[model samples]
Target: MYRFIMSLMLVLPVSVFSALNYLQEDITNDTTWTIQDSPVYIYGNITVKNGATLTIMSGVEVYFMLVEGDGGFREGSELYIADGKLIAEGTQLLPVIFTSGGDIRSDGDWGCIAVEDDSVVNLNHCVIEYAKAGLIFWNLSSMSEMASSVNYCRIYHSSEVGILFYNSSPTINFNSIKNNRYGIQTQGLSSPTVNYNDICSNYSYNFRNLSGLNQDATSNWWGTTNINEIEANIYDYYDNHNYGVVDYTPFLESSYFNEGGIGDKSLGWLRSIFVP
Candidate 1:
């Protein structure tokens, strides 16, 4: 009788494990989540803390469960990183994906991927969509060999903001941040080296500067060559005197990365012209 019951439990456990992997609790140890376990479902608020490292290999998709209308992400499911590192090393051929699990195409389907307080991120070739805020960087002083970077990613359809930079500096280049309420919002003296991105076509303002510090956001395509059109989409010093002005001159006349996929840009450097 004991052996029969044990066999029953083992059969069901293997079947359930093969279907989905639910992730929660604190990641206290250095771990690697590979593509073999492709779809990781976030069941509750999970955190990577205590200077640990969480490396997510290429072609992995992270799905977050959500409440229908609340969308605050207080529903026990979110990913937060503090005093740690999240190295999601995706490539041009295969990109990492983050989206909702509710089978809905609406924005605010989930919360956000928040990285704060000395957490280093090397996020490349990723597609983050349908969240309250796609990614949030707060109070990180990443530098030198541990410099943080967000490259060759597609961040869009966020209900509030595509990316929020607060008191942090990361090399943000070669990204497509569009179709959101706010493409990028800066505050708390955040100074991201914003370049080589397609920042345009958001529902509200593309860029807003509440940090009150002059920013040098340059060399990026704004979906238009007309200065007035570009300025209209941004909320900066022109809209409010207290805010800092975004210097967006020498911008790219066309999209730098290819439309085919992530990091499919041409070999020769592009200047004031088409990038891909």
Candidate 2:
């Protein structure tokens, strides 16, 4: 009886392992997911077909592993939600992360996360950083064109613009956007409710208004020198939130340090508040 019990235990373990492998293989062979040429790269530029709910699972690290010499990325490697809703709903602990497989220390690496007009992108608890830009919304024709809202996300270390709302009116609330060229750009008639965000010293304007009618409301912290321009809702040369001055640290060292030891105190506030 003892010999038979030991044999059963060994057989059960093998069977369970085999079952798990089979399940994994079945998922790998799923026709829904199309693996691109680069194993780590995936494209979302193509129009999201109707009746298909594309869900990217947690702990899945999708990187834009396109190098400069390797013909570069084919226009849209990041995300281009032209029509359908791209739901990247991640939890606080298991936030869906999108990163560029470039040197983390280097500047200007990958592209942006552009969700076009009229499309619903429910992105929560995601870390979209170290790319070209964080979120690029293009609906500049009018204020009503703005449609997306990013909540509880950390958008940092982007190449150019952090969160660029070109012509779209997006309610950018409760996000930590830092260390980029332009922190948050609102051009044309995109009058988003910019409140409760830690938009600190990017390269150029922290929050710029190209169209004179753009309304940059209140309750948010703009850590640029041109705080008056964004605060008073005025347009001027000095109002340009130029140069990284959130804490005088990123300008010296390429590395970005959160408000902890020797950085500016305001940056800590910017990193804390959530507009939502």
Output the number of the lDDT-best candidate.
Answer: 1
lDDT of each: 0.76, 0.52
Supply the global lDDT for candidate 2. 0.52
Model 2: residues >4 Å from true position, as ranges? 1-40, 43-52, 67-76, 103-105, 140-147, 223-276
* Alpha carbon lDDT at 64, candidate 1: 78
Lowest lDDT block of 10, candidate 1: 260-269
lDDT of candidate 1 over 64-179, digit per residue (tens)? 77644433333325688877888888888889888886655578778888887668888999999998888888774433212788999999999899998888777889999999
lDDT of 2 at 39: 21
Candidate 1 displacement at residue 184 in angstroms: 0.6
As for candidate 1, its clashing pairs are none
Model 2 lDDT, residue 175, Cα: 69
Candidate 1 lands at a TM-score of: 0.82
Q: TM-score of each candidate?
A: 0.82, 0.62
